[model samples]
Target: MPNAIPTTELYLIAMAIIFCVPYLIWRLGRTDYFAPLVVVQIVTGILLGPGVLGAIFPDYYQFVFTKDVIQSLNGLAWWAVMLFVWLAGIELDLGEAWKQRRESAVTAGMALGMPLVFGSLAALALIQFPGWIGEKAQSWQFVLGIGMAAAVTALPILVLLMEKMDILRTPLGQRILRYASLDDIAIWAVLAVVVMDWARLERQAIFIAAFVPACFLFRRFMTRLPERDRWYIALIWLAVVSFGADWCGLHYMVGAFLAGVVMDHHWFDRDKLDTLRHNVLLVMMPVFFLSTGLRTSWEVGGAVVFLAAGFLLAMQILGKQAGVHLAGRLLGWKRGEASVIGWLLQTKALIEIIFATVLLDKGIITSATFTALLLMALASTMLTVPIVTPKLQRMRELISRDA
Candidate 1:
């Protein structure tokens, strides 16, 4: 491998292309209705990665994503995702869910449970085909991992979409957030369960056993600090917890979420936190997306990957719809409400990618499987605004007529 360009210069060039190309396409192509800029960014990542662009322009791909360049990019990707996940944890409104406990529990449970069951069934079928299951994963782990990945609500991306839809402050939106938040908790817990290493079970046990008291002490310490100091302190906390979780075999992402979950969302200013998230997404997360794309493969055959992705998407969409509709019937929600909620809840992107990435990292799933899930998540997320926008408009019209 001859170095045609300085490693640092190539990295800068990669970063420039990462941000610029995606922005131009997203702005010029006007694909926001079906694919938000973030979605476009993800798609671009795949194209720039080995599966597409590298396949087409092998020499250029090698020149840009060289080993050293990739390492530098990976460091940015890791911190970016951790910060994003931590922010998501901080945004969790469990207290609000507790207030709406009955409604939240029923809706969240069904919304999550149905897709999980459906996805696990899909996993079972895929496992029989070979090249789908991870080498290190058990039958149960692979099944549960796929199921849970399907059930994920991508709370952070949910917030972004909801805000874009102008529903973030609405009662209906708050209701949706509560359900997603509860599901988020369940998603991570299930991940922890799936990744549990019996050989290191004692270490996992010790980590959990110690984490509680540490959280309490940390919370108390955070409370005493000035708000200005909290942000800096929290990053330090994120690093520590993430390290601990990885050390215990749970993975750093889980630790990142746990670090955020225990702290008070109100501890930091909401607007500033939102700004921080947006900045990370704008600056750092593109690297994550690119890194994610670079991992995509079609070794199972492109046709098989697409077919599997289609099947999983159908299962997730139908399963989520069925579950939400069931809850609506039981709770007596108005007509059209369930459909809208179901579509919105089915939105998956950031968190789903993270979940799939973690599974890939743990050798619990093959890259082919990851690629399928990636496609599924992109389609799932892209469908959200288009599907829900019209429903929301009709909902408002109905309210107007009644008034």
Candidate 2:
């Protein structure tokens, strides 16, 4: 199958094109207008999706928007996210992460707390939406997932943007880094609690139980071992990890993420995992993101849909603004600093979008509600493209001057 072309190969090719087109837009727009690339990517997805282009090609749109294809790609996309999230843990310079712990916690609490409340309520209100809305999203679990995702921030995206603007090394940038890192970790832990399947949860517990002591033991063992054979042991664990999270309620990637954190000490060896993560991120991240676009269908209809959509936007703006504002006040940070940090966390992402899709597929939510939530998420993320530039410029001036 790897080498053979299926009848549906064209759809796959189209999907691939959709994926890269956004990145190109991002690159091209990087210096031109405000977050032009981000805007283009999301708009491109909407255009290619049933929302726009899907209307033009309803029949073929089936292949493009099929449950299986979009779902599988979403899976792959989230897997890439897992690797990236895992890599985040491994790359953590803990000393630096720890230095700003106080502000990190303050900011994280602001970002994480408010949105969680807003999203959960949004999810609940969606059920009351009483329309062709996604019924699957009406549940406590599904609602919780939506809230958690909304309440959370996209660490990888934020980090990438901060680096691009050269804010990461600055004090405010540093605060964002610390705060975003903590937020990322919180996201993982929340996912684990809400979504881990039975098998996955079991393994997760074992990994958690053994992690600290095992790290200590591995540290000692590795120091004493002849350098020649460490690769063999590492290879075995890699295989174990590939299937590890899969057995859990989570994906193999989640297991892979935990594997990364557990094996963080292997950072010195670097070659094996870093190379794998780089490959995964480069090849699959965009694909995963594109898949998100494809799965989005405007066909979902209902009064609740509009309500959910409006609520999502409101929560995103209000939640971030409130969270960051509070965190800033708590820390005596400037209004601009808190506002920027708040915006950073509330942004939506492909992984959480896909994860919500997963819940929808499992019949965990009603279709209308699921579609509504998807619409909300897509809108929130797409809006970020427009909002980011103004937020970043103001933050840079305030933070740079503060420094």
* Per-residue C-alpha lDDT of model 1 across residues 1-403, encoded as one tens digit per residue: 5796899899999999999999999999999888888999999998898999999999889988999999999999999999989989888989999998999999999999999999999999998989999999999999999999889998888888999999999999999999999999999999988887778988988998999999989999999999999989999999999999999999999999999999898898988988998999998999999999999999989999999999999999989999999999999998899999999999999899999999999999999999999999999999999889999999999988888
- For candidate 2, write residues 255-347 as lDDT tens digits: 555555655444355666556555765666666556555655544444546666777778756877787787788778655666566665666
In order, candidate lDDTs are 0.93, 0.62
Worst-scoring 10-residue span by lDDT in model 2: 129-138
Strongest candidate by lDDT: 1
- Please provide TM-scores, in order, for all candidate models, with all chains considered together: 0.99, 0.76
- Model 1 residue runs over 4 Å out of place are none
Model 2 CA lDDT for position 100: 65
